[model samples]
Target: MNDVLHPSLLLFLGAAVVPLLRGRLQQAWMLLLPAAVIVAVFSLSQGTAGSMTLFGVDLLLMRIDALSLVFAYIFAIITMIGALFALQVKDSTQHVAALAYAGSALGVVFAGDLITLYVFWELMVFSSVWLIWCRRNPTSMAAGFRYLIVHALGGVVLLAGIILNVLDTGSVAFDKISPESAGFYLILIGFMVNAAVPPLHAWLTDAYPEATVTGAIFLSALTTKTAVYTLMRGFPGTELLVGFGVVMALYGVTYAVLANDMRRLLAYHIVSQVGYMVAGVGMGTIMALNGSAAHAFTHILYKALLFMGAGAVIHMTGRSKLTDLGGLYRYMPATLLLYLIGSLSISAFPLTSGFVSKTMVLEAAALDQRALVWLLLSLVSVGTFISTVLKIPWFAFFGRDSGLKPQEVPWNMLLAMGIAAFLCLYIGVAPGWLYSVMPEPVEYNAYTPGHVLWELQLLLFAGVAFFMLLKFVGGERKITLDTDWLYRWLLPRVVTVAHRVLQRLWGGLLSGLMARLRWLVETVNRHHGPQGILARTWPTGSMVLWVAVMLAASLLVYYF
Candidate 1:
């Protein structure tokens, strides 16, 4: 691959040309761009790291290593899948935006320095938000605005951290930093925001479901996953990530379990899936990092598959609420099967890609003697099973048919989902193909009698518990409040109350001030025809006499 015609650069520049073209040409440009980048990346077997300096700081335009390559490969794969899923959409604006969004993420993965990473980091934010707005609905417009604000805030934090880091260390290398200082902490917090570590996690669930069908699939693949990659690159072994990951895992499961919207449920699971990867990165072992990278790869596949499946259903029926849909399996058997495969993989079921990858993270926790973290991870497995596999498909496709008859999705959409679903099974059945490309060599085995038995037991017993607690766990008509509700609901209510109080206070103050001023004016007017003595103007003669006296004093001083 020529450096001048670097695949990523060519793809990005070519994507910008897509909207100018029409129909088949635009579609070809959109689909081929990611394929070209993937080919170029594969051609370079050994890793390469290089940077360009600007403004006295290094800007890493290209850094090819095993870690980045792993993410880069999946990002490209998901982008291709997304393009296929989006073939039905004739809007060139969306097609180009999706390609640009995908390219920006690939650029970030290859970035060797903080400056280049930041540039693409912000590009990811802006380019992706267009996907949401492409929905062209009021809800999506509002959600996109919120999404922009959240990422804009994250970008600002990231920029501040990078600037402070360059000032403090005189280096812009995007390497791991100790979280013991303010600068490092600032960078960590910025990364955490995108990682959806906590309170900030609301952005994904709030914004993603509002995006257009194909748009949601792309959204599922990039932003948070990029954050995960950055964390793996920049904050591996940070103890705080362990706690952060656990919280996100549990947080995602809880909200997902309570969620009613089909896409929103999957959005919460994104946070949960990333939680596993975050914990793996925090473990910082060869096995754990491999698991993190591999899980992230597979997660993008299955997660996008699930989102595409959901999108297909919504596309036909024009509804996204799970309660509003059911019995779709009868008409769209392919969709049903694909969704099940994705669900099973995401649940870490045996013979699925997730089983092959997620185990390493759990094993890392156990090996590190973090028993509490291990136990929590196990609970998350159960939560994941309940929310995604059992809940999502059961409610969306298997429950009572809502008397809706929609044909199978378009050939291209099904083709994309099929590719992803097949990979889920292929990778699970044969893990070596994926294991070979890991960021680091791993000796741990994914298939073991003990591991299989425990996972089966965990999932089996969780199933039994769900049955036993069916009444408690069943879906409801109510919406569960999340952190976003405070700003979106409670804060506005509080502000409204504050405004009323302030208005009343200001009205009273103005009335009292007006009364006092009126009284003063009346008293002055009564004393001096039109106003007070001081308010009355001096006579012209007095003014002339004062000017003459001043002139005489100046003349006397000059004479003296």
Candidate 2:
């Protein structure tokens, strides 16, 4: 009944009960819990709660500021939506894992200190990987392990940074950090890994496609966005991030074009879309930071919706490869329609959620006079349209028929997608509703005549380009090598080679050792063998003569 309760606490407690209940009651409880959290989140006032000192340092379990509240709100909304999408799932473990993952993400958002943040930060990794592993397939399991290793390393890096920062500052306050401080870049890399920045981002595209149909919805929403929240909090205005952000945006677009798996392609777009957020954090202006937060919110919605549509296809057809998918629009017209809304939203088409949100970052860029940043981001938008809007839709749903004839997904899935789809359109049509939640005041206008005109032109051009390069853009039935190849292919090969070398070296040393031992045995045998002089029947005569000589010498010496 406490109004000051942490949303994460509620979710964690709810996750424990999911396995205990059954049937309709269990489903009802699952939906009710996140619904309640959403209400509670919106009801919260700006302040900290659950304050106490741990090991001589004060901690706030719930810090309800504008920024944290922004993330918390969207997180709660997506948890409910994800739960709804997963309502038909029979696996209680998956439900528990999904809820726990969402809770941990909320925990990260509201955490008022590095220690509290870390506790939830790690919990997010442990809880979310199950979504992948729960699929109970070899590919999913392998990808899950890789996901674990990458995040585990990232967590170690972040923890080291926290330890160094704490030692240097004698405090664990999670506030705006100075870049000159000791743990700055380490913490940034830690956050960057979560944000799915390039080189460190392959885990996303690698694992997300392998998750359960419903579980992919949550995966697409939480992990990387939470990293963006942290980056915005910890390292805003670190100009180095501008370059990193640009690379992430382009990197995602590039690989997404190569992706044959529909979900994997969308996963790459996650990295691309989050790039705007990372750049916004780097810009550090109020407008820019708000853009980052706004984009995270909108991204979670549209991205989750997109995943829902993709998952519905995968669930029904038992296939995910774009090369294998076609003429799906004829059978799954409704799903295609819903998915296009998401596709258009992601492309920042006019009057969509992406339009209202993504442009804020671009506006921030232009205002900052970062001409190259603006230009590159604009190009990423073009690529976004080409992939998600033009390429994916055409190839996956309308290209050459692969003889698929699946029906529409379940009512719950449709309802979930419907809700997200509606929201995407609604937010686009009414930008004020989303803008009002800005951590800072909203100043940039998304629907300006010039802005809308320019965006339309860019997308129009991208559409033209896609058709021109249609042959080149269709999904191929092949695996596109990524950074994951380092571990998946190269590392194992390297280990195998090293093992062989070590074995040969060990064999040579053992051979030399045996040879030396053999020679020593031969020398010892020669000294004591029956044919040797020392081994001959010596004797009594020699001994007697020697004894007589020794006695005579002793007698002479004594006389002298």
Candidate 3:
């Protein structure tokens, strides 16, 4: 390994040259960059690769540990897949933004200091927003702005926490810390915001569906997963995450059930799936932490696969709402088949990646004797099957035919989805391949007979319930509200009303002051007008006589 050359630097520098290339050359360049980074990642030894000191503060530019390596490997692989999916896009700007976003995520994964992490964190924020804006529509534009605002706020919170932590400890190292101080709590808030934990999560659902088709693939794979990586690294063992994670798990399912847009439905599932990882991090046991990391790895692949499948549908039909799509399977069987693979994986069916990864977290909770946590997670798994597996595929592919005949998406898109689908299956069948790369040793088996039977029963019952309530759970052409209402609607209205009241008060004060000044001017004019004593305009001679009289009086007084 070249000690001085960081893998992230390779992608970032490569992004700079992307706009300069054209056609086949650009496509080749994009593919080569991620492949080269994969090589760089494999060649490096497990330690800090690039280190430096600035102003007496130690900075680790590249930290190659088991955890970071796992994330870096998946991130590089997804970047390559996203590039492949986007090969048909003629816009260089989207390509550049996607590459830079990938690079920033890699930077965050490997950063060994608070400052370095923050720099990459902000870069991720800036670079990813462009992917949303690249759609060049009003909805995308507005969504991109909202995305930037939310992340910018998260960045501020993170910076404050970093500053306070550095001041308190006099060290800038990025390591695990207990949430015993104001700084760590603030830091957790920052991480949660990025993780899209419930109320702070609307930005994700708002922006991702609005992004360009190809851009949505990258958006789905990176941002929140990076935050998952950070939380697993920094705040593992905080009990608060357990509760929040459960709520997020259930909350996402509820919204996804109500989601009308296909992409939006998938967007909500990201929250649901990430909730498992967050809960595992909170559990803080070796198995749980390893579960979180492993879940992140599997989630990135499967979720991107899901997004790619959805993107292909939208690309072919120019419609993403479930109401507008139906009987697509007849036309795009390959896409439908590919999408079902993702759906099964996310639903944690037996012999899928989700089963392999998500069970670790649940088993940890069960071992810890958190009955409520275990129950809630179990229920959420059923909801996941209902919404993602049953609702999404049934409505989009097999529901009432909309009489729209659309061809399959381009080959590159199918190729990307194919690769992800294969991985999801491979990981499920050969869990050891994934478990071997985990941060800790793996002793748990996902394919135990008891576990498989229990999961099958849960999924089977959920499938039955979904069919029974299909009418009620059917997609409605209505928008459901979330915590985002506070900022998106309520807060803006409050600010506008406050502005009106303040404007009226200011106007009244100005009017009163003007009226008083007018009255004073009138009084002055009344006393000093042409008819008044001072304004009688005494001649120069009269003025001189008054001066002489005063002088004579002065002299008489002096004589006396």
Candidate 4:
């Protein structure tokens, strides 16, 4: 065993053997590999490791630092958690895809140069699409293809940016640069696409709900979060993100409020929650960046927990719509309780992971005196509570009884959710544990009297508003049109119309061409066919008589 190793390589190499193993051995290996990466992450010293030269360019494969370590730590933990959650899956392909996806994310986090980052960036896209495809349904298959096409476009944009950046600066280091050039803007666009920033985020909401039960958990955890890590690494302090982030936060909440499907609702919330991190990163203060990282860390746990609860329901009931689910709490009380923990955590209820983490971003906004930013963030928080805590729990678990009698999910799922839920409470109760791992040091307190009172009052009022507007806020069975409608419906219709017009033009051209050919054939037959004048049996005799008469006429004219 080498003393210095890239954590990604361990998982990537380990995934190759997964399909070869069977039964218990396979599960054990899947679990053990992520655990080993965790150990490897902590064992290594903090500096560039696994540096090499490729095409005369220095490629840094492992760049361990506080920032990278935070993402790597959470990624490793989630991989193990995802593995445990997926233990009962009979398909080897899911496990392989999950592990490989995890590895590629690690690769992105640890990559020190643009080239290395781009390589891993693409790998993440390719590997995670499997999670969608593994569902093997028409919806999943189609969503998978759409997911690939969108990310492929993003990837091409990112690659173009890298090439241009390298050409301009003569360096491929994945460090911050001014957004004054085409390369930088393209790169930022690429990162934002992955981050699920609004207008570019419909793929997440569209595809995630269609994934396999366990695969959704993994999908929810990694892709957007990796994009956050990259943004924090490269585009911190970029002011445009502040606006983008705020819109994302509110946009997600607005849509989630209207969503009818359980997983799609949660998927929308993923966008909403990630919005907080994006805003924090854009703020780019010590506390804000820390908040972004901390929020990302906690978001993964709670979001995964939330997905697990929803997935368990789908797994047991074979239904995911809010209209179809109700009275589940009567049968699955434990799941309900665990899921509530996640709900509280996401809503940033006091003494939960979200409270400890999300407040940092708010605090940063306040300290920076960005009053508008702070106000919007506060409102978004209230919306978060309304959707995830009030709407979701009420409709899915306790609302009008569709008479569902789903039993508790498998113990493995329960265990995974338990671990995540516990961490949510643990981090909230003990904020210092999370604060210590932050990339930058901050002494901000989340338990101040003013802070707690403000949070409580806002949540309390939001709760009141929810019940008052309960009828209006209730999930409808109607499909909400999003930006994807432009591509999925509107654009397709436009193309169909154009295609019909072209088809008519082609048909007319062919008809006219055939008509002219027919006329030419008739003329040729009349002039030269065997039955025509020139081709008759007496043609030679008639020609000779005409020639003698013409000669005699010419002689008479010359004599006169």
lDDT (tens digit, per residue) of candidate 1 on 1-560? 12433445765787778778887877777677767776766776554545555767656677777899888888878888899889879887788788888888888888888888888899889889999999998989998998898888888998898888877877888888756445797788788888887888888899999999999998999888889999999988887788888888888988888888888889999999899999888888888888899999999999999999889999989988877887888888998899889988998999999999888899888888999989998899899898778776777787768888899999999999999999999999999988988999877787899999999999989888887876566566777777789778998899999999999999999999999999997887877765667668889999999999999999999999
lDDT of 2 at 463: 88
| Candidate 2, pairs of clashing residues | none
lDDT of 2 at 380: 97
Model 4 TM-score is 0.94
Off by over 4 Å in 1: 1-8, 47-50, 468-472, 505-516, 530-560
Among the numbered candidates, top lDDT falls to 2
lDDT of 3: 0.90
Candidate 3 local Cα displacement, residue 32, angstroms = 1.4
**Pairs that clash in candidate 3:** none
Better of 1 and 4 by TM-score: 4
Residues 1-560, model 2: lDDT tens digits: 22487888889999999999999999999899999999988999987788888778988788888999889989999998999999999899999999999999999999999999999999999999999999999989999999999999999999999988888788898998777679988888889889888889989999999999999999999999999999998988989888899899999999889988999999999999999999999999998999999999999999999999999999899999898888899888888899999999999999899999999999999999999999999999998888888787898889898898898898999999999999999999998978888899898778889999999999998888789888999888798898999999999999999999999999999999999999998887787787766688977999999999999999999999
Task: List TM-score per model, in order.
Answer: 0.91, 0.95, 0.97, 0.94
- Sort by TM-score, top down from the best: 3, 2, 4, 1
Worst 10 residues of 3 by lDDT: 1-10
Who is ahead in TM-score, 2 or 3? 3
lDDT of 4 at 330: 91
Query: In order, what lDDT does every prediction score?
Result: 0.85, 0.92, 0.90, 0.90
Q: Tens digits of per-residue lDDT for model 3 on 125-226?
A: 999999999999998999899899999998999999999988887888899965655589889989999999988999999999999999998899889999
lDDT of 4 by residue, 474-556 (tens): 77879899988988899989999999999999999999999999999888778778666666576688889999999999999
